[model samples]
Target: MPNCQTESHPPATTTSPPASKAPQTTEALQAEQAPVARDWRAPSQQEIAERKKQLSPDQFKVTQQQGTEAPFRNPLWNNHAPGIYVDIVSGEPLFSSKEKFESGTGWPSFYRPLDPQRIVEKHDDSYGMDRVEVRSKSGDSHLGHLFDDGPAPTGLRYCINSASLRFIPAERLAAEGYASFAYLFPEVKQVLPQSEPTSGR
Candidate 1:
C-alpha cells in the first residue's frame, strides 16, 4: 500500500487498538482512525510536458498522450496469474492480479480494485461512448474504464488498458512492501464456481 491514496479508510495494515478495552474517548478514537493527510498537488501542464521528455515515445504516448494498447495485444489481456497491477505512469499499485479474470470482451479485466480508494471514477462520455472512466485517485492519471458486467461480491470489471498497468506477482508483494497484506491470500479457502459464489450454500 505504499504511495497509495488511502482516501477515506485507514490503511488495511494499521494496528487497531485492542477491542477488549471498554472503548476509549470518542475524540481519541476518531483521531486514531483518520486517514493520513495526503498532498494532492499534480504536475502542471508544462511540468507534464517536461516529464514527458523523459519517457520513451511509446511510454509517453500511453501514459501522457492517453493512448491505449491494442485490444488483446498486451500481456495482461488474458492474465489470470496472481499478483497486482500498478499504474504505468507513477508505478502505483492499483489492482490485484488475484482478482483478474476474462470478460471475453478483450482488454484486461478485474473483479475489483486492489485499493478501492486508490482510483477515482468519472463519467466518461468520450467517443460517443458513455463509459465509467477510471483514474488514479492519488495521481489522477488516466488508467481506463470500468464496467458492471464482472463476477460477484462486487460485480465490477475494471476494464483497464494494459499499457496503463504493470503487473507484479504475488510472491513479490512483500519485496514490494505490501507484505503486510499477505494474510489477504490464504493457502486454502472456500472457492466457488464462476457461475456461483457459494461452495455449498
Candidate 2:
C-alpha cells in the first residue's frame, strides 16, 4: 500500500470565534458567498445513477465506490499548475493550489480545503485501518483519506484521489465562475486591473 493507506485518527476539533469577533477579509467573504450563489444541492438517487453512467469507469470506481487509484499513476498527483480542484460530480470548489503541497506521497495533497464547509470528514475504519475519510458535501463523493502527517500551516494532509476532482486553472477561474478565488493567485491578481481608468479631466 502507498502513503494513501496511512492510519487515521479523529479530526481535531476547531472552534470559531463569535460572529462579532470574527473578522472576514474580502477574499474570505467572497469565498463564503460565491458557492451559495451557485445553489449546489445534493443529487437525487436518479441523478447519481445518471452520473454513474456518465463518468468513466475509473472515476466511477474511485468516487462512487470509495476505491483508490494507484499512486503517482493518476493524472493530478504531480500537477503543479496554479488552479483549484472542484468536485467532479457537483462542481463544488474543494482545494486551492495555494494550500496544495508536494507531499511526496504520490497523491495530490493539500494542507487545507479552499472552504472547509464544503467538505465532510468521516471516521473510516475499513480494511482494519482507522482513517478519516474526506468527501464532498453536496456530491457525497468519496474523495480520499485525511491524515495528520503534513507540512504547516495545517499539519494535515488531504490525500485526494485525482479522479474525484476536475482542475480549474487560475486563468480560467473567472470564466469558470470562480472569479472570487482568483485572488488566491498573485499572478492572476496582478494581471487583473484593480480599477477602471478615469477619464481625463
Candidate 3:
C-alpha cells in the first residue's frame, strides 16, 4: 500500500469590500446649509430679578409689572434720532428709528419691529377692551399695545412704551455693543471749504 500524503492547499486570503456611502437627502443638504439658529430664550428668574434691581422704578414698572408710562411724558416718545430701540431688560433689538413715525399717540410708535420674530403678540382683554399686546420675545417685557390704525403698507401701529425700551443711538451703536447695526447710519461727506471771497474784491 502506497501512503501518498497530499500537501494541504494554503488557505485563500479574504478581503473586505469598501463601504458604500448613502446618498444625502434634500432635507439633509438644506439643513446643513441653513444658518444657525439664534439663542432667544428668556433669562432665568435670578437674572430677571437682577435686571429688575438695576432698572429704574419707571422701567421696572413698564417691563416687569406691565405698567404703562404717561404717553407724552416718557423718554424716547418723541425721539427722532437715527437709532434702534432695545429691550430694557435683555438688550434685544426691537425696533429701528426708520420704522418709527408720528402716530399722534404721544408714545413711541412704529410701523413694525426690527424683526417681527423678536416680538410676541397676545390678545389683551383687560380694561374691557380687546387689544393686541406686544412683548419682547426674549425679555418678556410688556412693550405696549398694537393697533390697526397706522399709515399705508402694514397699517399696523406698535404703540410701545418708552420705559420698556433702551435707545442705542446710531453714533453710539459701536460703543454700546451694537456695532452690527452701525450700517444704519452712513458717514456724512465733508463739504469742501468754500473758496475765499477775495475774487469779489
Local distance difference test, per candidate? Answer: 0.57, 0.74, 0.68
57-117 per-residue lDDT for model 2 (tens digits): 9999889999988776889977878988998887788988876777666778886787777
Q: For all candidates, what are the clash counts?
A: 1, 0, 0
Flag clash pairs in model 2.
none
Q: Which model, 1 or 3, shows the larger lDDT? A: 3
lDDT of 3 by residue, 115-176 (tens): 67678888888766677788988788999887766554455668888989999777776666
Candidate 2 residue 175 C-alpha distance from true site, Å? 1.2
Error of 2 at 182 (Å): 1.3
Candidate 3: list runs displaced more than 4 Å. Answer: 1-45, 188-201
lDDT per residue, candidate 1, 1-201, as tens digits? 111111122212312222222322212323323232132234465765565566666565666555665564567877766766876655566776666765654577766676565677788775666777788764466777766555654556677777677776666555554453444456523232235456784
lDDT of 2: 0.74
TM-score of 2: 0.74
Better of 2 and 3 by TM-score: 2
Model 1 residue runs over 4 Å out of place are: 1-56, 186-201
> Which of 1 and 2 is ahead in TM-score?
2
Whole-model lDDT for model 1 versus the true structure?
Answer: 0.57
lDDT of predicted model 3: 0.68
